[model samples]
Structure formats: structure tokens, C-alpha cells
Target chain A: MVDVSQASGAEGPAISMRSRLSPYALPIFLIALIAVSGIVSPAFLSTSNISNMLLQVAPLGIVVIGQAFVIILRGLDLSVSSVMATAAVIATGFSGQNSDVLSILLIAVGIGIATGLVNGWLVTKRSVSPFLATLATMIVLQGFRFAYTQGAPSGNVPPLFRLIGSATWHGVPYNMMLLVVLAIVFGVVLAKSRFGREVYITGGSPTTARLLGINADRVTIIGYVISGALAAIAGLVLSGYVGIVDNWVGRGFELDSIVAAVMGGISLSGGQGGILGGLFGAAILVVVFNAVLLFGLPVQLQIIIKGMVIVLAAAFYVRRRI
Target chain B: MTALAPIRLSSRLRANQGVLVVAALLVILLIFGAFISDRFRTTSNILNIFEQSTGLALVSLGQTLAILTGGIDLSVGSMISLLSTLTSGLIAGKVSMVLPVAIGILLLGLLIGICNGLLIIWLRVHPLIVTLGMSAVLQGIVLLYSLGPAGSVPPSFNFLAYGKVLGLPIGAVFILVLFLLVALFLRYARLGRYIYAVGDDEVGARLMGLPRARVMLTVYGFSGFCCGLTAIYLTSRFSVGQPYTGLNYTLASITPVVVGGTLLSGGKGGVFGTLLGVYLVSLINNVLNFMDVSTHYQLIAQGLIVIAAVSIYVEKKKRV
Candidate 1:
């Protein structure tokens, strides 16, 4: 069984003194993967291949940031994948061949916010468990996307939006930049903000939080809403990357995000984890997929490997928690 | 006496079957069916509903057991897919129909259920995460084995599916048998009581030294076994093993389990309630089809029904 690493206090100077070495384990795994791949292909370390890895991981990284928040609140949101799909569809629809770009962008953001709010309300007000509620939402939204687009996906992302996925400004891709920005925002929120502390309290022990006058339900709802919003943004970047919108956009994304979050050392039972840890987890996942491709493993085998990693990560997380 | 009566009423409410909500929904759909088309009232259409509901009901029983232990088995769908493919593929391979099919399904189920249990218990992980991963792994394995759908059911199996027994479809008989077995186990078995105790509170059960690990393993194992059984029957009914089959089983299974009044948190509900829930869901779907509502509206309606059922569960619990 895995052991929980050293802990940082709930606040203040105690946090910085705690070693940031938790991410070291994940990075070592990545290096090992890279090393193994290099031995096989000799071209695994090429600049282009490395960039490809980052690009592939960026969409999932963004979504994992949201997943971290929800899990930290001791809740899970299964709707992020569908929220991503809905957002991508809406964004693509508005980004018609001829349109004012700004208005379309606004609509996309608005739709994302609205989706998050609905998910938040259902879980908070209706008292539905996050699991079942989000699942229903996910299916319903998927149905909507499928119905709207029929079998074929229509519309392309605008050139501007696509740039974020494709362009490299000063040799750094826009998606990578977005990831960095999200990381900083999430770091500040989780480490410095009052709301973040409240989230932890809620997840650590809901009954205690309620006793302490904390609105645990509200915090939980907020956590999911944040996750939903982040997933929407991730969808925007994803659609940009692909240059097209499809009904199946972000299919099984929730699974990926959960895997990333768990592997990154974010506990599934919630209350203790960092956003950067999740990003590293996402990186490790993408690298594994890349290595599999490099080795020419069949897609089915690749799925099996991915599934194995997910189970391993979760198993480790649970052991560490206990 | 009045206060005592209210207390008894509350207990009954707490222990009450979730079938009524499902039944009420079915009646509503029936009226809608009558209003939309006269064909809905036809005997064959009703029979078709029963036949189709059979496969889902069988799988839902497995789902009910897993959920009863305060966990889920997403792999049930994938297990069904794997077993269906195996059963048909074995028959297609000119293997003995009964033995190969039985062994194949059982092996797949045992392997998957054990993995889930080991991951959750030995690995100390959440059931959802382990099962989710297992689902993917199982799906991949099925894909690897089948390569592409290539299997056919033997005539004997289909006889059980399409043939009549006591004027009831064989599929319906299978469902009834499953219900009876589950009801009996929950009522009489020591391990079954342990399952209820564990679901009510894991820590408390452990403190009581109730063989928590064994209970967990057995419940999950039982779920896997039932899933395998359901897969065989489903393949028989469809007459073709589909590699990409059971795509919808995850939701289809859960809808009945949840609507059956089993608490998602575990430690409540039973097989009989699941039977009613299964029929109610299938009946609603049938009635919707009869009304000729666009297929698009069907999912939305299903989603609404689950939400409504959970909402009622929550409200009832909140009141007590």
C-alpha cells in the first residue's frame, strides 16, 4: 500500500515549507516512459514529438483543473464531458463562415456559464448526489448535441479560436499558455483564497462544516460549477485544436480528468490536492498514450493500458488516504 | 398509539418499495399511449415490451446487488458485451453450445468481478473508479477477442428466448427466476444480511466483525455472476453476439436499480422492487414508442424520470 506523504497545514507559512516533491513521482514515471520510448524509436525526444505531447495533454489538463476542485469538495461531476460537448457545439455553431467573431465568443462563454449553473442548481437545491445528477445531465446534454447535429457534425471553429490550439507565439503554443494561466489561477484560488479553504472544510467533513456555519452545500455546488465552466473552456480549445466541432466531442473526458486528478495525487474523497499535481498527472497520461502510439500498440490494447493506469492511480490514492 | 403509528409509518416509508413511483410513471405513459395510438393496446405490442424488458431486467438484478453494497459496477455492461460475444463466438466456432457458453460467460464475469473487488478492497480504492477502469479494460478485451462481430447463437438458446413457457415468454420466466433467487438470498442468507449491514455503515459493520471483506467480495462476485447470466440470455434473444453491444446497459441498468427504490447510498431495496422498476421503465419506453414521440424525446424523458425518482427518495428521507 502507498503511504500518504507529508502534510501542510491548512494555512500560512506551513504550506511553503512542505516539500513540493509530491509531483516528483509522477515526473519520474514520465521520464521513464520517455526513456523507454527513446530506446524503441530513437526519435521520441524530438522537439516536434515533445510539442505534440504537450498539445495532446493541454485539453485534458484544463479539464482536470476543474475536476480537482470538485473532488476536493468530496464530490464528483460526471457532466464535464457533456458540458464540453455542449460548449463546443454552441461555439462552433456561432463561429459560422461569416459572422462577427466577438458576439459568437460571448455566446460560447454564456452557454458555458449557463450549463454550469444548471448542474450546480440540480446538485445543490434538488439534493441529488453529484454522481447521479451529473450522469443524467451528461446523458441529456449528449442527447441534445446528437439531436442538434444529427449524425454528422457541422461548422468549423473561427480562425482566431483555432489559433489558440495551433499557433505558437514565441515558440509556446497558445494552449500551453492557457494551461499556465489556468494553473496560476487555480493555485492562487486553492492556496490563497477563502473560498478554497471553505471547499476543503466542506470536503474534509461536511457535518462539521455545517456545524461551523459553513454553507457546505453551496461550496459543493460552486466546486462543480467551476469544474463545469473549466470543462467548457477546455472544449473551446479542443474544438480549436481539431478545427471542427462534433457531437462526440470530449467523449470519455470525465474519465480522463478523473484519472489525471487521481494520478496527480488528488484524493478522490477530496479536501487535499493541488492543481499543478493534476497537470502533471495529465502530462503523464498523454505521454503514455504517445508512447503506445510510438510502439504501434493496437487501439484496443491502448485502451486496456489506459484503464490499468486509472485503476492503479485510484488504488494508490485510496491507500494514501487511508 | 398515534405517535407509535406515525413511527411505524415512517419505518415503512423508509423500507417502502420504489416500485410505486415507477408504476405511477408507467400508468401516466399508458394514458399517453392510449391517447396517441390504438396499436399500443395490442397484445403483441405488450408482449414485445415484456420480451425486450427481460434482458434489461436480468442485468438490472446484478446492478441492484452492486448498488446494495454502496458501490457500482460499470463493467456489467462490458461484461455483457464480452460474454455475449463469447457465447455466440463459441457456438460459431463449432464448440458445444451449453458447456462452452456457460464456461465462457462465467469466466468473464468472475475475472471482472474479482478485479473490481481486488481493486476496491486490496487496493483500497473507491468502487466507482475501479469499476470505471474495469469497464474500459473489459471493453478493450472484448474488442480484442471479437476483432469485429463474428458470432451466432445456437437454436436452443433462442428457443428459450422466443419460445413460450406457461404462456409467458421464456425471457420473462428468466427474469422471474432471477427475482426469486435474489429475494430469497437477501431474506435468508447470512452473507446477505452482512451486505445490508455493510451498506448501512462500513465502519460500524467492520467493528461488529461481520466479515466485511468477504461480504464485499461476495456481493461484487455475485453481481459479476448475474451480469454473465444476463449476457447469455441477451445474446440468445438478439440471436447475434455484438462486439459493440451493451453500449446502453450502464444507464439502462441503473435506471431500474434506482427507480426500484434501492438507495444509491446502499443498504435498501430488493430484487422484487427491481423487477417492478424494470417493467415500469420498459413499459414507459414502450408507451412512448407507441405514441410516436420522436426518439429524441425518449432519452430526455428517461433522464427526467430518474431525476424525479431520486428527488422523491431524497424528499422522503429528508422528511423522516
Candidate 2:
């Protein structure tokens, strides 16, 4: 996407260098973290450990991709966690031993689309603030899950899910491969598609985008629907990984995705950054967690470090922008 | 003259619509509650509702201030958890340690507030993300301090929650007094006006040469202080320092603020509306309890209520 002429035309080499450097920063940081972890404990560099970490972070990476889209539209889906839980609950609760897994997946996707439509209608039609609207949806969905499951979810995730969730091929995790393929597809769509350009324009300025004849409202709704569907996919994967369903499933995924997206340099203000940034951000967070584990620190310390990283990255970005 | 009078009256009514809506809702709910259950109107039950609302009232007050300045403080809940644990740990059932513990907690609150304000002002980050990060940090700190509930509160502290003053619950009285003080400050203080101005239009307020950073800092600091006060009350009521006591306070506090008719985008609404909002929520919970409805329904109801309230309020504002 970088054109040498455009880089040299207006902003000069300094701005171009910064722009070029920013996208690669997360991957470099991930490598550095991996090196540090390997130095701390050589076992961290083992193939098994690396594969395991990839499997664990794959779901988060998927969710982060979805979050990146919504955030690019200058909106947020605080309901993602609840949406994930609802999807998992629906998938398992409806699917019996003889039930078809494909139909269950379809049902999950339907629920995601319905929830996204509700969120979109509230934001686009009713003019509600995205934060409050999504939060309200989150709370309502949580209650719905509780009422539906009656405090405990039943039925087991299908074996197909298990295969996808935990199986590997030639030393690479299937889930990780799924994440990589999805990431590439989304990255291409964001970089080379008209819809992606419209998203950037709409987020940059709704009025301007509308003036340019872009269907801002339609775009926003579609963005939310995509986010919902992706979140449900993540939920499906997570349910398979855990092998059971509960109301608390995907409890913190929303915040985790947001953190990863922000750390990847996706502007919260929207209209900038890409899915690749989100993937890199998710990878960095996973590596950090792996490093923390290798260090044998308490889980609480991991939380503390994660919080510090968010604040520090935000501060750094703010300073750089200024 | 007659034409001007109607116009003025309509404008005044529009200005007070939030309080009016919440007050009307409260009255209707109260009447419905009384009709549904004989115990709903009992003196003890009414007092209990008021007492239970005190913590939320304090937290909402802080939230209102932050929101008025076009910001939010998600960390208030976590601050409550941390302050409660820290104060209760220090108290350990000793009345002599209350003063020092309380001061320490308040100072810590102020320090957190300062950090939040400086980061937002200097680094210029979105308040939502900043506060979210702060909440996570505070959660970690609380976890580090105590894995679970710990420490016993002094009896003197208990009086703040359970004591009676002039035949009314002390907690209710405290909330009323605090409400009046905040109302007066918002009505009369220069800083309060500046807050509204900044929230209404940051560029305009800056052009007017208002001390934007200081106003933001004071707003956050005041919010932190409210959290500290809430921590004390919660600790007393529970009789122990619970690490997760304030887990729901963040959302709960926001509910009242939004339901009270305060614009989420800021620059409108008042603490008076918040008072009515708090009572409205408390009454709803009380009624649900009386009707034997599960708490799960209440959660759903709260969510619907927030969405409905914000939608109606924003639509009204737009029309005006």
C-alpha cells in the first residue's frame, strides 16, 4: 500500500520512515519478547511450547480481527464477551449427540447477526453512544444467557469442534492455521477492497463520507454484523477448546481484543490501521503471557504487567502523534 | 408578555426534564410497589431501600462529575475495592486506626485520580481506554493485596452504615447532605460552570482561557474521593474488606447517571436528577424482591432501562 511517490511528495522521508516502522513494530517486539523468554528459560523456545502458545492465542487473534473492524468504524462492541458466551451456550445447548454441527454453527452465526443488528440499530438509528448501547446489550445478553441456561449450560461441544480446536498437522496447530488464513483474508480485504476504503473514510468523518455518497449507515451496520459473526466464530473455537459451556465463557475476550487492537496501533479514533496490526498485537500479547509463565511469576503479576503495557503503549502512541 | 412567559416556562421545563422524568418514574414505581406488596410501604423497608442506595449514590455522584467533564471513571469500582481492602486491613477492628486509615485511603484515591488526569491531559488519550487500563491496574493491585475477602472493620465504622440519625438511617442522611453540598457547588461554584463549559465545547472553553487541565484534574480527584467514601460505607455494611465487593459498582453507578438523564456526551443534567435516579433503581430492586422475581430479571431490566433512557434523552436533546 505504500507508494514511494506519495511518501516523498508531501511528508518527506522522516514521516515515511515512521509510518513504515510503526506497522512492523509489534512483530519486532514479539520477536524480542520471544528471545527474552528463551533466554530466561530455554524450554520456552521448544517447538511444543511455541505451538501451544499459538493454539491458545488463535481465538484471541480472531476476536481482535473483528474488534479492529468495529473500532475502525469509530465504534466498539462491548457486547462481544456476552455475544461469545451466548453463541457458545446456544451451540452446545442446542446441539445434542445426534445433532448436526453445521446447523448449530449456522444458529450461532444467526444469533451473532441478530445481536449485531440490535447494536447497529441502537447506534445508527437511535443515535445512542456506542459504549452505553453496547454495554446495555452486554448486560441484557448476560441475563439472557443466565435465564436460558438456568445458571448452567449443558451438552458437549461436537467432536468436529474438538478436532478443529486441539488437533495439529505436521507440527502446526489447526486452530493457528485457521487464524493465519483468516488474518490473510481480512488483511487483503482491508487493504485492497472498496468496502475497506469506505470504512476508513466513514470513520475519518461521517459527514464527509456521506457527502461523498457513501452509505455510512449501511456500512456501519455491516461492520457490526461482521464483528458479531467473527466473535461467534471465536466463541465456537473457545467452546471447543474448553469442551464445555458456561455463562462465564468468553468473560474477558472483549477487553482483551480491544487491548490487542490498540497495542497493534489501530487508532481507537478509527479510520487508520489494519487487521495485520491487530494480528501482530495479539501475537505480542500472547508472547508476553508466555514469557510471564516461563518466568514462573504469579498470574496476578501477569495482569499487572498487561495493564502496564496497555497504559504505556497508549502513552507512547499519544506522544508520537503529538 | 404572555407569549414570553410561555416561552420561558417551556425552556425551564426543558432544562429540568431529566429530574422531572426520573421523579415521575420514581413516584409511579413507588405506588406500584406499595400496591403489589404490603411490606413495600413499611417504614423499615423504605429506610432499608434508602440505606442500600447510599453506596450507589456516592459512586454515581463521582461518575456524574466525571461525565460532566466529558470523561468517565471506570476505575471507581476498582478504587472502591482497593480502598476498602486497604482501610479495612489497616483498621483490623481497632477504632484508633480509623483516622489514619481513612486519610491513607483518600490520599491513595487522589493519587490515582492524579495519575488518570495527567495521563489524559498530557498524553491526550481517550478517557475510556485510560480508565479501562486504570481499572485493570487497580484490579491487579487489589488482587496482590488480598486473594479474597480479608480484614475486619471497626465497630465505629459500622455506625456509619447501620446507625440512625433523628429516626432516619445514618447512611441516607449522609447521602442527602452530600447531595445538597454537591448541588450547591454545581449551582454556584466557578469551577462547576467551567466543567459544563468544557464538556459542552472543549475548543470554545479553551479559547475562553479556562484552566481545562485543572478542571479535569479536580473532577477526577473529586470522583476518586467519592470512591474512597463508598469504600468506607461498603466495608462497614459488609463488616469486612472484600476484594471483589465493587465488582458491579462500575456499571451500577453508570446506570443511575444515564437513567438520571445526564447526557453521556456530557454538558447536561445534574445531581438532583441523579438522586431521583438512585431512588428509582433502589425502588425497582426492592419491588422485584417483594414480587419474588429473580435477580437475573433485574439485570435484564436494568440493561433495558439504560438503553431506553439514553435513547429517549438523546433524542430529546437533538430535537431541542
Candidate 3:
């Protein structure tokens, strides 16, 4: 008997109620899980357990921020892992004492921007669909990484850079803080700025925004560039942590980011979501992954579970999509 | 009027596709081949190109179908991996090659196709997410089955991949059969028209009473079936089943599908064009190999070509 529109309007309160309560759900679940683990072993919530959890979440969280931006524009960047791998290798290659670390970082970021330029150029100017174009970029970049690395990664990070991965400042890891700062910056950009409004407008209705002369192409390009740059930053973080460069350094990162975005209540169709949603989603994913390890699951089984979570996230979004 | 004329002209710049770019690249490649190497023009080399393209050709054909429906299949590569893994392991375990291969491959295809369809339809998930999840699931299953590297296909199986009849590779025959079947279905069948109709405008198709879900389900299912067939030859040709073998095809398959004149937005291209696209990509790979260019450079070039092809398509579509 409830009209659909009326029902949707009513959904606001319901969703807010759900949102307010949902944060506690995961934490509660984690605590319960910890209690169970404690029952099994007194060391379940030990320092190493928490550090390991943070370590796994840090790299994925950095990439997910980039993923969040692109998804907000109703686009995808499938090349994040490849970008990470390529950037990581590039970063590692410049690890010598005499090597210009700053220049290498710039060059690595430049590589990402270049990739983004191609990706954005095709999508905006060439009219390639975001899905296919990004996917192609991903493959090519992956291949490029493999070719450049010659399937063997020998470069090591300089000690200073390695500290970013292994060292913590004021009892917090630099990478984790990097993620927190990015979350705030992204939060403001999407929620406060003129560019952010343009993003929402462009995503909601590109043609309508065009009629208003919002420069849809430019906005889109900026969004993708941000994604690419952030992904490169993610590579930098990963390089600092992993110590050694490998060809597959960022493998399957695109999926992880997408999953995080969806979990954060950012609709895949675009123009809906906040930084909080994205961050929360990333937290949830990391927690679940930690849950898997804490629960003693095998690696292959973990992969399968992650895949299931992705599908379930999509399914959840579809059900709640307005 | 003159100043306005350019604006009008610019709007017309977006053509439906820039297939001509690929055609030009094809010509350039041929010219390069002629200039660089004599073996390029030989019958055997050309035959070898056709033979080499079989797996990709099949996958591209499936990609074309998926793209036509305004969707994609990330699961195809995973499907290939699973089929290759299962086929090799089963064969190695002394399972009869003939019946087991046929039934096992078909059943997996159906299962995968149905799983994809059901998830997409009933759960209302995007094709990308569903297939991506399916890809991981398939990878898990394949890994579970093989547990590691599986045995190579019996040499006799390779005959389908390596054999020739009257100076033609059997792969050429398989390609021909697949093309004809696809061509016939798309050209003369009710389902075929329905596919194009749905691709053009799903809402319009629905208004016209097309079975949109059915068509989508069928196309995806058929894509999975083709993966099975492709896997049969893959095991034969490679002589081994690799858990990671099919990952590269995810992108390589799309190059041909996009190059074949299909719109990634869906409902605008067909298998014949995909066949041509496949041939073009196949030829490029072979020519690159013949020229002795390092594979790394070849990959970079291939990536550039993909961007160029899609960019051209986008430009052409805007013109139209």
C-alpha cells in the first residue's frame, strides 16, 4: 500500500538509522570474534595480531581511496594494481644512496599521471567507455611492468623510504596516517568544493551538466587523474612497506578498491557517497579479511571468500540502490 | 555560415567507429612485414597466424557477443583457466579423452553461464562485479582441482590444435565452424535480432516485448560454451594446463572485440567484424615475433594500438 516514492523518501530515516547503527555492528562482531579467540588462546588480541591487521589494511586502503573517486564519477580504473606494481618497481629501482629519491617519486607519479591521461583522454575525447578503456590500460600497464622488470624484481627501497613501510611515528605508521590524511582531503573535495559539485553533476547527468557548460570532459579527466595519482601514492606506500619490488605488487587491487567503494554505500552508477562511506567500507573489508586470518582460513579459501564478499556487496547495493 | 559550418563539421566528427585506423594499421603492418622479412608472405606463416589465432578468435567472438549486450565477461579468462585445468587433470587421471572432455567442458560452461546469468538477473548485480567474483571463484575451483600443475594433454589431443588437413590447420576449421554458427545465429535468427535490439536500447527492447533476460542469459551462456571449446584446443596446443594461463587473454580478447567494430556501449557490431579484428591482432603478434622485437616492446606497442583503436572508435562515434 506504500507508494514507491513515498517509501523511498521514508528510506532516508531508515538508512540513517541503519548507518548510525552499522558502524557498531562490525566492531561488535570483531569484539565477539576476539572474545571467541581469547577463549581459544589468551594471545588472540596480542600486539602482533593488531599490527598484522593494520599492515594488511594499509596498502589496500590507500588504493581504495583512489577507487572511491573514480566510482563516484560512475567510472572505474582497472589499472591500479598495475600502476602500483609499475610504480613500486620504479621506486625500488631508484633506491641507491646517490639516487635522487625525490626525482624517482616524481617520475613514478608522472608514470601514473601519464597512464591516467591516456585513460581519461580515451574516455573523454575518444569516447571509449570507462570499463573497456581502463581494462585495456590495466593489461597494457601490467605487461609494461612485466617487460620492464623482465619478470624479475631486483630493486630494493632505500632505508629512509623503507622506514615508511616498517617505521611508525608517534605510535602510528606513516602509511596509515597517509591514508587518514587522504580520507580527510577526499572528504572535503567531494563534499565541499566547486569541483566536487561539478563531479556530482557530471556523474548524475553528463548531458544536463554539459548544457550548463560545466566542462564535463575536464571534470571527468580531473577525477581520473586524481584516481591515477592516488593509486601511484598507494604504490609508493606499498614500496615503502614491502621492501622489494615485484611485478605483481599490486595485483587484484582494482577489485579490492571497487569492493571497498561499494561496501561504503557508494553506488556503482555514481553521484552518491561520501568519504566516510568509503573509509568505513575500507575498514569493513580490512576487518573481514582480518577475520578470515584470525579464524584460521587458508589462502585460497580467503580468495574465494573475498570474491564472495564482492558479489555480496554488489548485491547489497542493488537491493538498496535508489 | 562558414564559421558555423566548422562547428557542424566538428559535431559530425564522431563517426560510429574508426575501423579504418585498424585497416590502415593492418596495411602498415603488412608493409613493414614485407620490408623486414620475407617469411611474412609465405603460405605456412600465414597458416600459422590463422592457427595461432584460434583461441583468441573464439574468446573475441564471445567478447563481441557480451559487448553487444552492453555487458562484459571478465569470467571468460577464468573459465578458460578452469576448463584447461579440469580437462588436463581429468585426462591425466585416465578419464576417456573423447566423452569426458566433451561432456565435462559443456557442463562447466553451462554451470558458469547459468551462475553468471542468475547472479546478474536475480541479484541485479552489474555484469562486471558478478563476473569478477565469478573469476575469483573459478580460479579457486581450478586451483582446487589441479591442486598444482596438472598433466599435459595426450599428444593425440594436440592433433586438433596441431593437425592439418589438405595443408590447412584443423584450428582453421574450428574457427570457420564457430564463425559460421555465430553468423547464422546473429543474421537469421529471432534471438539475433533481439540481441541487437536489446543492445541498442534495453528499455526500448523491453517495450517491444523482447525477452531481455533470456537474451542476456543466452549470450553469456554461449560465451561460456565457447570458452570450453577454446580450452579444448588450448590444452592441445600448449600441451599443458596452467592455472594462470588464461589471465593474459582477459585483455587480448577485448582488443579484437573492440577492433572488430563493436561498440563497447553495445548493440552495434557483430562476429564477422570480430573475426577480422582477431586476424588483425593475430597478425600483429606474429609479425612482432618475426621481427625479433623484444616481447616487452611488443606489449607496449599492443597497448598503444588498443588505446588508438578505442580512441578512434570514440572519435568516429561522436562524428556519427
Q: Return the top candidate by lDDT.
A: 2
Candidate 1 lDDT, tens digit per residue, B86-116? 8788788453667766777787787678768
**Top candidate by DockQ:** 2
Residue by residue across A23-141, what tens digits does model 1's lDDT show?
57777877887788888887678888887777878889999999998888777778888888777887677645436457665665666566667667766677666778788877777
The Cα error of candidate 3 at residue A111, in Å, is 1.8
Give the alpha carbon lDDT tens digit for every residue of B19-122 in model 2.
88888888899899889989888999999999999999999998998888778888888889988988788898888888888888888888888888887887
Best by TM-score: 2
Calculate candidate 3's fnat. 0.60
Cand. 3 TM to true fold:
0.90
Model 2 is docked with a DockQ of 0.54
Candidate 1 vs candidate 2: the DockQ winner is 2
Please report, as a residue range, the 10-residue window in candidate 3 chain B with the lowest summed lDDT.
B311-320
lDDT of 2 by residue, A46-125 (tens): 99998888788888998898888888888888888988888888778765553568887898888888888888888888
Ranking by TM-score: 2, 1, 3
On residues A157-208, what C-alpha lDDT tens digit does candidate 3 reach at each position? Answer: 7666677766777657777877888888887887778888777767765676
Give the TM-scores of the predictions, in the order they appear.
Answer: 0.92, 0.95, 0.90
Which residue ranges in model 2 land beyond 4 Å of their true spot?
Answer: A1-17, A95-98, A319-322, B1-5, B315-320
